[model samples]
Target chain A: MSHANLLSPPSSIPPKTALSLSQKAPLILAASPTSSLPWPLSLLFSRESPESWTIHENLFLSSLRTGDDKSARLTLDRMTTRFGADNERIIALRGIYEEALANTPAELEKVFQGYEKILREDPTNLSIRKRRVAILKSLGRPADAITALTVLLENSPTDVEAWAELSELYASQGLWAQAIYSLEEVLLVMPNAWSAHAQLATLYYLSTPSNITTLSLSLRYFCRSIELNDTYLRGYYGLKLVSQKLLPLLSDSTSLKRNNDEEEAGPPPKLATVKKLEELATSKLAEIVRQYNAGKTGWTGLDEAEVIAAKALLDHGGIER
Target chain B: MAQPIVQTIHRDPALFWWILLPITVVMVLTGILRHYAMILLQTAPKKQALPQIRQQRSLVRGINLRTHAKVLPPASFQARKAYMVSAYQEGKFLADPESRGKPRPNPMSDPAAMEGMMGMMKGNMAMMVPQTLIMGWINAFFSGFVIMKLPFPLTPQFKSMLQSGVGTRDLDVRWVSSLSWYFLTLFGLQPVYNFILGSNNSATQSTQQMAANPGAGLMGPEQDPDKLFLSESENLEVLEYKWVLEGIEDRLVIKFGL
Candidate 1:
């Protein structure tokens, strides 16, 4: 059978409409009889009605230290058929569906059917797309997963979580340029995102085959990342990385002056920022050195800048030998 | 005596050079010049008998992390690049699958067809082959790329969620202490498999294996398939909180060979 048809089973699953989070608010409010149960748990176990079967399933789920496939299957069927088409029951049952699929051999695609039913109802749901992507990846359909993520992004570019997941997928696949590009998109949406900068720097440093221009841009992003979050260790380390290239430049007056000229040509604020960084690196090397000494582990690839800065401090006799 | 059928009516040397020489050259280049022209003409792209799986949310999330987004949200440039690559990759992945799946007739089968196909294909192939190779190479290279770049340099803002604390309690530090070597060893396995198995054949094999033995890639050896199915349907909270993580780990290893 065609995979699409397999997913869209002939079973009498109700067509989904809008899922009403507001309608379910009251159900979520009711507490379980046991005072010891957490509020989240209470919300799940308070009732046995079809309206609350989703919650009941969750309650039953929490108690099973090991997996309970039969109960899970029963809950999924009840949630799928009895609950309203536009209910979050399918969504709620997703966890159980995944577990059952993993543990049970026979119901692999049946689990897929539930997921498809959800998507068919709410195609734009980012969460649904995220779920679908996971299944695809697990099934070794990275390419298909990539497609779903792209579709999600097109609809919802601001979905930061989706973007992050997509980046990891690319990284796993060794698509550095694509990975680097995705990280940049994350920064575009959330400018203060320092880790994205740090990761971009890493991609350029490790993956891109020896392009000085890309390397320099990577350093520039790291510097900006540092400015955004001073405590960001990755940014400082990235600086050290570029410093390896900058070392020769720092010694060459021609390059130094050229850099100065380039800085001068740019916006004044950026140039001032560069001067500030130079001062910080010169003075703050001591604290970094102290931290390094205080810490047991020596360094990581991200720590190369601090290492360089410490070497400079030691060379200048800033710290007691 | 029968007259030799040497009709000189169509003796246009210019036309021969213009059409036949280039065609001959292309056919030789593609190495499929031996097949009959009629067969080549009749060939068409075969539809994939493989299952058409819409991206499930977990799979999407995994792909996002593995390929595009190494670092999670609230990170810095890593996030942006992750987004960009994802958008780009998705766009590529969503392109007409039929066109992608269509098998081009073996241009190398007939010298004329080979030459013609090569001439036309070379342009597209030149542009596409490197892009594809690079894409695959990037996927393999990224595991190390992410570790080298971010390596939990700071308590990434998201760190509070993954694991928290200021000085000694960094998750990356702990993860490094525990999993760094493991990651390093694990990281190369996929690329090595990809190198040996080749992405096209290996990816298909893995998927088939997963479908055949849904539990094969799962982490534990003594898993009861019946229990797994029952648990998945009956109890969701445990599935979400506990089994899902385990499931992802097992599936990733099987899928990526990580």
Candidate 2:
């Protein structure tokens, strides 16, 4: 399948409709378990496709999510029977089930203890280790969670999910520099992730107290993000916001003078160039809002709240300029 | 002894349509059938319990760490290596903690090992049974007949095997019986099978042999990944670390001239 098709449902099928269909899947399967068994089970027996496993796994997760613990347990049992109880994925699922069952902090603590015991026996269980980190974070132990996640990252540097989680944890702790570093690690693993680029720009923007250098760095990162994904609403929004903040700094020579002794936060773009880029961002944001507001087919994917916010910015920038 | 002049025998054209073509078609069909049969016979992979999975994947994780260590900085790699080596030595990731330090059970006795062997046996059987049956069918019906002449020459040693049904001692080895035609189709129809059933079809004997061979080790359940991990840990411990990103900035400046 083409990557675009894989990412988005066919244009004929709306995303919300597809989501509702998936949501209704567990209900249908729960209603007719026997009929569901024949097709996937027969496919399993025929060995025509291994995709049946993924279908079953999704069914299990959905069942768990919908509070149909009985069906969830059944699907889990079926998966364990097919794959074996020791399969890595099944173990992860079992951990998730335990997490779902733990209503009280005490019960969560018990689950935490269970994970620790399992980790003691098998220190390399990265999934369980991740779960332990999550439990620690939930239990208000950010330090322990950070340490655990760092160790996990050391072993599996390519784990994008863990890196993203660690970044969030660091961000929550107001460790801006560490959060930026962790997000950079995420970028290193998945350099083309435009979302991460925008996120890192946001982080950089938030880190310093309205410094010209930091604003410029944030602007460049936002531009890089928009360069990777042209249609990214958040990237364009960030670009406009950062540039608006930057334009005044560029015009004022005194604000820039304070940071002259420090290392240049990259080669600072010239004042005229910064002004031009800010205008470009404003124009792009206006175009996005206009297109999205007109109910254009392709622009339907743009967030309504963002479009409204952009419109407000355009109106606000009109008076300021 | 005096050498005699070569004598050419007139062969019937009817043999091509009557025997060779029929046998070729049958062999191809059997191959397609065997491919589907093998697909039907294949069992889904048995799932391992969480601890077993942990034990297997933890070792895998260590091996991955060792292999991809260059991706990490020196400090991180050192920390991971130290942890993995110590954990491996202590049997921290053993599926059953009580079973550690005890000698491994004979693979023959292990149920999982037996299942692997059974899968191999099934593949071998799938390839062999149809072959033996076809050979017998050809031999019973089409014996004592010279069907066609090969376009190449063979030594006198082949005469006993290839020309088995034909009692004529003076016939060239190239002028073989229908049974030899069966053997030719058996070995030579691999490409035909590939075309008919796709490349990874289990119908081909050569592939089955490759799977059965311990050196190829492509098929069958793997030997315990825990043991594999332990050995990998030893390898990682001994490996000389050379940090690839040691002077990354300098290299970048040299490349990009920024």
Candidate 3:
């Protein structure tokens, strides 16, 4: 399952990868279209891998991403001919194509109305529903976008992608409880998503009253995140914060006794445990920062923004500061 | 006890070229035909409305909640369990709440159900038609002849099957008739097809037929979602929950040897 993801458009395409992928768009288009004829006729020609269509789809997206609109248009045309313009997913892709090429606010609005028209005709097309949400967000109507996204979620509650987007929207609006609930819904669907665990931990950390109860929740979640993926820089950075924050809280025996009085809430970790975890996070963060700064091969995939942020956290010293 | 007599039948060597060979070749070719026919018959999936999607996904969401409740914190888990139990009991997530607790409509009356049945029927037809034709052909043309002998020994139970057309009760179980050869090729020509048409080719009947039961009926028109929701609710209620994050710090410290 650890595929190279040549079939699907990568969620976040690095500049180097994006350029390399867009460069292949012409090559794919030049392959002169594999047989789309049904079975027996299809058998006469060079067999098409099921991956070919998805590859073309991804190539189309990457071509758009890298501003190769000519190639993107060609790929889009090829796909439209194969899948037809009326196909639901292709219609969404075409919408994205228009959105990317729009020069002014008016054109964007036109694209928005087009999405609305499609939705009015067929309200059940989930892809168009999502594009409408995107358009509304880009148009600076956060309220409308939220409503659109919620409607999308109501139609398909198991869509972890939509749930994550909902969480992102709520987090941006500073609605901590709703944001956390959306993320928890995401975790409910995909429990072992380490990034999601880390994201939820961050929401808890950023929420008001960084109390012992909340801090400890963040601490365990970050621990779980790193447990799932030790190399995760954000997990290490968040762990460094919570484990340090809990150090002083755990040191005070009176605070421990106070926490113990709340029988339903679990006991916080011992002071020594917190100290060890804090040291572990600090060392791991330092190592990651060092290796990443040295331009090491394995560490190169770490997001540049994240590596810098980790470096800043390390430089800022501890919570006592 | 006296040694059982071996009933050896002398047959012309030309029978190998004329009878056994042609049946196997035809069986293999027929398999290839069926494979292509199946591919041609495959229908594109039909899209569902948003409400139906919501209904199906709601059931799935509850199943996901039940499946991964252990990953959630105790409070979150309890809250979700309570809400899901209540929602399921109330049948709040049904695509059409009016259909709740109602008996499923007869499959023949539902067009979607009818389409599904038709696809299965087509698959059966694709399988059954050529087989009965070939079987009848072999019976009419080659039935009276004893065709081939097995190198290895077999039990007496195989006599009824392997010596089908020949009425002799006392023939050695290892000697097989032409019809039995056809039966043998029907079950065994997959590797030959794989060599010719590639491994995933639907030329093989036994293995391919088993795989052809398309999950077209996945939460199909038949099931009462209200019942599914209730059962899922009970499943969630009875789940033994353990939060993965509990004591995760100690596990991490030990893992990193800090």
TM-score of chain B of each: 0.17, 0.85, 0.85
Name the regions of candidate 1 deviating beyond 4 angstroms.
A1-86, A89-101, A104-110, A207-209, A245-321, B1-258
> Each model's DockQ?
0.01, 0.08, 0.69
Arrange candidates by TM-score, highest first: which order?
3, 2, 1
Please report how far candidate 2 places residue B77 from its true position, in Å. 18
Kindly list the per-residue Cα lDDT of model 3 for residues A130-212, writing each as its tens digit.
Answer: 88888888888878888889988987899898899989999889898889889999998888899999999988888855478
lDDT of each: 0.44, 0.71, 0.83
- Candidate 2 lDDT, B1-258, residue by residue in tens: 877555576878888899989999998889888877887887865645556655655665665666656544445467668987988877877767786556667878889879877988888888888888988898888987788877887899988778877898788788878887788788888888888666887788678666554532312234554566578778988987664433332332233233
Q: Where is model 1 chain A poorest over a 10-residue stretch in terms of lDDT?
A: A1-10
What are the runs in model 3 whose C-alpha is more than 4 Å off? A1-9, A36-41, A248-265, A293-300, A318-321, B1-14, B167-173, B194-220, B238-240
Compare the candidates by lDDT and give the number of the best one.
3
- lDDT for residue B211 in candidate 1, whole number 0-100: 33
Better of 1 and 2 by lDDT: 2
lDDT of 3 at B133: 96
Ranking by lDDT: 3, 2, 1
Reference-based TM-score of each model:
0.35, 0.62, 0.88
Q: What is the TM-score of chain A alone in each candidate?
A: 0.54, 0.82, 0.89
Best by TM-score: 3
